[model samples]
Target: MAELSEQTGVAQSTIRSLIRGRLKRLDSISTGKLAQFFQCKLDELYVMKWE
Candidate 1:
């Protein structure tokens, strides 16, 4: 996580929050950074479920 954070310039806390399902919302810029770090398309960064 530290490595990824450094590589992607995204904070470790943010990544942790996202992974732990604690994030209620995430902006497009952060999402884009994560997607780029993971070498995936922006749409693949997250999935939405209707509740």
Candidate 2:
């Protein structure tokens, strides 16, 4: 987790929040960084559900 955060420039807490599904909205820049690091598309990282 620490390594990912360092490589992606995303905070560990933010990643943890994402893992725990506590984030209500996504930050495009941060999400994009994660997707780039993981070599995946942004949509593959998470899904949006209409409420």
Candidate 3:
């Protein structure tokens, strides 16, 4: 999570919320940035359950 935040330059809280499926909405620019950071599909980030 910290790596994601650092890579995307997004706050840890925001990343945590997204990962937890608790974020109500996402900013397009931030989403694109995260997608790049993870090197995965944008939708893959929001897993419904914790792993």
Candidate 4:
């Protein structure tokens, strides 16, 4: 997370929160940004099965 945050300039806590399912919703801009950052489809950024 620290590595990713440093590379992406997004806070590690924010990334961790998203992975932990704390941020359940995503804004359109963030969706596009994250998708491009990870080099993946927009759908991949979404929480599909919510562990």
| Residue range 1-51, candidate 1, lDDT tens digits | 999898878889998988767775668888788888878864444553222
lDDT of 4 by residue, 1-51 (tens): 777776666667777777776776566666555667889864555645342
Residue ranges of candidate 1 with Cα displaced over 4 Å: 41-51
Q: Return the candidate ranking by lDDT, descending.
A: 2, 3, 1, 4
Candidate 3's C-alpha runs over 4 A off are 47-51
Best by lDDT: 2
Q: Relative to the unseen true structure, what is the C-alpha lDDT of residue 31 in candidate 1, on a scale of 0 to 100?
A: 79
RMSD of each: 3.6, 3.9, 2.6, 2.8
Model 2 bad stretches (over 4 Å): 46-51
Q: Estimate the lDDT of model 3.
A: 0.76
* TM per candidate: 0.68, 0.71, 0.70, 0.60
- Number of clashes found in candidate 4: 0
lDDT of 2 by residue, 1-51 (tens): 999999999999998887667874568989888888989864655654222
Candidate numbers, best TM-score first, in rank order: 2, 3, 1, 4
Clashing pairs in 3: none
Q: Which whole-number lDDT from 0 to 100 does residue 25 have in model 2?
A: 54
Tens-digit lDDT track of model 3 for 1-51? 778788788889988887667885779888788878878766765553443
By TM-score, how accurate is candidate 2? 0.71
